[model samples]
Target: MTLRADAAGRERDRERTLAWLRGVSGELASATIKRLEETLPWYGEMPPGRRSAVGMVAQAGISSFISWFEDPRATPWVAADVFGAAPRELLRSVSLQQTLQLIRVVVEVVEDRAKDGDDVLQEAILMYSREVAFASADVYARAAEARGLWDARLEALVVDSILSGEYDDELPSRIAALGWHGHGEVAVLVGTAPRQLEVDTLRRTARHMDADVLIGVQGSRLVVVIGRATPRDDTPDGEEPVSFMTIATALEPSFGEGHLVLGNEVPGVVDASTSAKAALAGFAVARAWRGAPRPALADDLLPERAFAGDPLARTALVQRIYTPLKDSSTELLQTLWCYLDTGRSLEATARELFVHPNTVRYRLRRVADIIGWDATHARDALIVQSALIIGAMSESAATRRRPTRR
Candidate 1:
């Protein structure tokens, strides 16, 4: 009976304390908001409606603490209740650091006012404040996770648009929204997707090398359009950017074991569709080249692409290599033709041209200066031979189409 009386008396004391706390709750909430406005720059900058929402949270914290003191086991409920009074948009408008500052300001006000209370009440306030801090972190962590997922979906959409070459005016804005840092030349790389692709690893690798990429996985194929994340020293005065082959070499480990193909470089990300088309076309026919390099250049596979009926490859060969030489000087063209036909032999080419071997050397060097390909190199010889065949055929077709000059 004595114990029961003690319990009943304690309950009455709690009821009296709770009434006092409720009476001063308004004053405590106003003081907390005043402290926040004076201390936190972000809080002071908040719009009036959000500030009111913040005030509601401060008031809710005071009420929740009173309840928590009455029932010590209500710690979890009290912590969440404080944030529940805040508007939904509060989480978006306010950063976690700012939210933490708000919590600190309110806790300071509560601690200052409640310090004169019994030791038990003061300890409860301290513990409750800790719980609130953790709960605030949880809220922001969840928001960050949701935002990451949304960005991933948006990135996939952007990559799909690039691959399909179907773009609208909104594409540039969407790319910007993805935080793409690339602003210079862009090249596309195509290869078989790895069995266990780690996308985060790929992105980290690119970032480490100061490059950016738009990655896409299409069935067994993996496509990446890569570019410099910042201006490169190698590209001073708008000179050609670092060779895409060097970038491809760095990224080769990201792909599977099969053949990888890198497209010709384009001016920028918006022009990447041109590079992507060439990469895709080259990748399709890469298997036909028995000795293809691991990261074969798209232009190097032009013959294979042309055999596979890729008109772009044929046009590229004729326009870039053949037309330039044919229009510059017939001597450069004839010397290149004779050098390739004579198996790159200086003496044989000179015999065919009825000139000294030294003159033939001069003409071959002139051809290299006119068209960047050196006919002496075996690979370049193959390219020159293909261009000559295509160019000759193109001229014959044009002549047949022309009205007979009478």
Candidate 2:
């Protein structure tokens, strides 16, 4: 009879304490919010809607503690009950450090108010605070992981749009979101994907070299868009800027065993699609040319690309090499045509032109200065010959299209 009476008495005491806690729950929540605004600068500056959500979390935390006191084994559910009251955006805006600070503030308020409560209530408060702290960290870690995945997907989308030569008004905004630092001149590089391609390592390597890249993997190929973040002083004055091929050479080891091609420079990132198209076209036909350099220029593969029916390569050959020479001097064109016809013999070219050998040498030097391609090399001679033939064919087609005199 005596044990029964004691058990009944303890039950009544617990009921009374729970009733008091429930009555003052609103008061406790208000005090916690007030304390948060005063103590936490981040909390004070939160927009009104978010601040209200945080207040709801604090209220729910106080309410959950009362429930947890009834069952000390309910530690696992306390964090969920408290945090679930807040909106999802709260987790994104509030960092783990700020969350821990909030936990500390709420614990202090609860502990101070419950000072005269039973020893079990005080012990429960301490245990609950520890659990909430760890739970807050877990929530924040998951949010960070989710955000990382989202950014990676966005980056991939932007890269895909650039490669496909598709553009809309949102491209600049998307690129800005990726924090692209390149301001001028962009070049695309295509190569075989490495066995273990570590993107972060590639970025670090590019940064060390004072360059930047946007990397993408398409099946067996790895495409990197290279840009100079800042100018380098190593280049001597009066010389052409360092070529993209040099940058490609430095990044060669990052790729798998296969040919690497760098496209011609474009004005800016907005023009990168042109460079990407050229690089991709060259990569498609790169295997046709045996003994291709490890880091080959896309322009160097013009003949192959043209033969593969790449219109850009054909147009580029006509305009860049042939038209420039044709518009510059007829003598230069005739000398080159004759030189190639005679199998690149200076004596034969000079005799055909009725000029001295030195005149032929002077004319060839002038051609080199104008087009930047030396006709003496066997490979360059082939490119020149292909450009001439294509240029003549295009001119003939245009002539036939023109309305003839009646």
Candidate 3:
């Protein structure tokens, strides 16, 4: 009989405490808002509309606490009931830390007001505050996760657009949204994709080198569009910008075992399609070169790419090699033709041109100077010979297309 009486008395005390909490809930909410304005600088700085929203949240929190006191089983809905009062944009404007601060202020106000109440009221305040803090963390964590997924999808879209050479007016805005830090020159690197790609490591590596990259994986191919994070004019004194070749060399270990091709640099990301095209073509034919270096330049693979029916490589050879040589002098072109035809023998070339061996040597030096490809080297000899053949064919085709005169 004594145990029953003790239980009945405790229940009556709980009812009286619940009544007192309900009566002072309005005063507690007002005090919480006043405390926030005084103690939290962020709250004071918020726009009037957001401040009102925050007030609504605080009021709802007090009401939810009353409901939770009546039934402890309502703990699951306490977070939803309190946070659901605010607008979705509130999450964006108010950081998780700030939300915790708001919770702390509300808890302080309730604890101060309920000091004279029973221990049950004080215990409920502590338990409720703990639950709300965890809920705020969960809300922000989910938002971050959703944001990360959206960013990955957007990045993939941007990379696909670059590789396909397709663009709309929105492409620039899309890149801007991705927070691209690249400026000025851009180059594309293509290689085989590794078994397990470590994207974050690659990004950290790029950041350390003061460069930026847009990475993509298409089947077996891995593509990285690299650019200078700091413009040339912005470079500090005596510190030159890191060259794309150096960046490529640093990033080479991240790629799978195969020939890695770096396209020629272009003026900007808008022109990256040209670089992407060259890199793709070079990568396709990289295996044709038996001794190709790990990070072989697309320009170096011109001969192989052209033989594989890449028109861009054919045009590059004609423009960078044949046009310059032809425009300079016919003698230089004729000498080069003879030099290669005679298996690169200076004596044989001199005899064919009816000149001294010294003249052939001088002309070969001019050829190297004009085209930047030294015919004396066996590899460059093949590239020069291929350019001559393609240039002659193009000239012949143009002549054949001309109108015949009577």
Candidate 4:
């Protein structure tokens, strides 16, 4: 009985030793990782105490192996299976069993703490991975903070100017002062996210595209983004959502869903702000016509953009006006481009291309012969103009899925 009791006590001590060793190894592993983080692209930053505590767990696991009355090298390797690294290498040429024994230590500590809780290893990985991803949290925080300040200033400018009812004169200077790059033409982007959060998302998205963002927000649904559109955006036709187009498409799934609309670029924010209203109107119009899930176009709310965003207008025109030339060989697309560019002046168009006016006249005649409509007539001219615009904007010259105009 005495000998048996001694054996049981020894076994109990062995179990305790293993548990402690595991914790030490896990802590040491984490510290090694932390020490190597700045060099590895993956080291995330967190509170120093938290970092150290995690590292210490693995460190304890390693040290316990050396003192647990085992051939430390041989024993650490036995723990390799649990710690998930070659314990032999970890324990400096120790056999796999020695390392694996240490891993048993870690698993015991973790299992004890989390007896009825979630997986500690997984939780540890999650916590560690998150910390590592934002290694420069302070830098991003500072940037995001500055971005917030800028947004507040801009939002105030928009609301103040509009409230004072001086939108016309105050808008241009107010916007230009924000440091936007392009001067010739610019588009408008409205967002569903709040100004502060949306600003962060947009800034991140812009950084993804190697650019910066300028922003303003009015109410919950009104977010204004000012930046150069780039080819890098995955949106169709480079129409940014929230920032440039419908909010739904602009926001990544990481952000969730909603609608956004981009307005046509106007001369100034006076016009731009007005255009935003028009863009909202365009969204409404496009929705009334195409319903939700349809892409709203800039011309949907603009005057001359009628056919540009008008679905039925173009289709009716295509079927009624251009059926004759649908399969013709008279180079109709070229003919239409020339006609529109010249403002329907055969003499001017022919002269610009050094073609005989009679030849220009004859082509129009052939166009009429094929389509059974003379473009020289104002009604016919408008219909042909629709066809031309659609042709320029779409994939095929033959026919098109009327842009999701709403």
Candidate that would win on lDDT: 3
Off by over 4 Å in 3: 1-3, 236-238
By summed lDDT, which 10 consecutive residues of candidate 2 come out lowest? 230-239
The model with the greatest TM-score is 3
TM-scores vs. true structure, each candidate? 0.87, 0.84, 0.93, 0.32
TM-score of 2: 0.84
Candidate 4 achieves a global lDDT of 0.49
Native-structure RMSD, model 1: 3.2
Q: Model 1 over residues 1-406: C-alpha lDDT tens digits? A: 9999989987787787777777888889889988988998887787899989888988888788877777778566554788887878988888888888888998899888877876556777788888888888988898899988888788778878887889998988988987898887788999999999888888887777668888888899998989887555546685665567887888899899899999988778888888899999999999888889989999998888877888888898899889998889988888888888888899998888899999988888887887778888877777778888988998999999999878
Q: Weakest 10 consecutive residues, lDDT, candidate 4? A: 85-94
The sequence of per-residue lDDT tens digits that candidate 2 reaches over residues 1-406 is 9999989988888888888888888888888998998899988888999989888888888888888877768656666888988888888788788788888999988887889998666777888888788778788887889887887787788778889988898998987887787665789999999989988888887777667888888899998988777543444587555567777887888999988999989877888899999999999999998978988889999999999999999999999889999999998999999999999999988888899999998988999998888898899988889999999999999999999888
True-structure lDDT of candidate 2: 0.86
Clashing pairs in 1: none
Clashes of each: 0, 0, 0, 55
**Per-residue lDDT of model 4, residues 1-406, tens digit only:** 9999988986676566556546555554554554444432321353455434434435544353334334334443322222332222222222234323333444444445435533433354344333322322433354457866885787667645632335665565666666554333335555454424545666666555433344544455554444443332444684643334433244433222354556655543444555555555554444344333433444442323344455534444455544446557546657756877888998888887678888888888888877665789875576577665554454364346556567
Cα error of candidate 1 at position 377, Å: 1.7
lDDT of 3 by residue, 138-180 (tens): 9899888998788889888888999999988888788888788
RMSD per model, one decimal: 3.2, 3.9, 2.1, 17.8
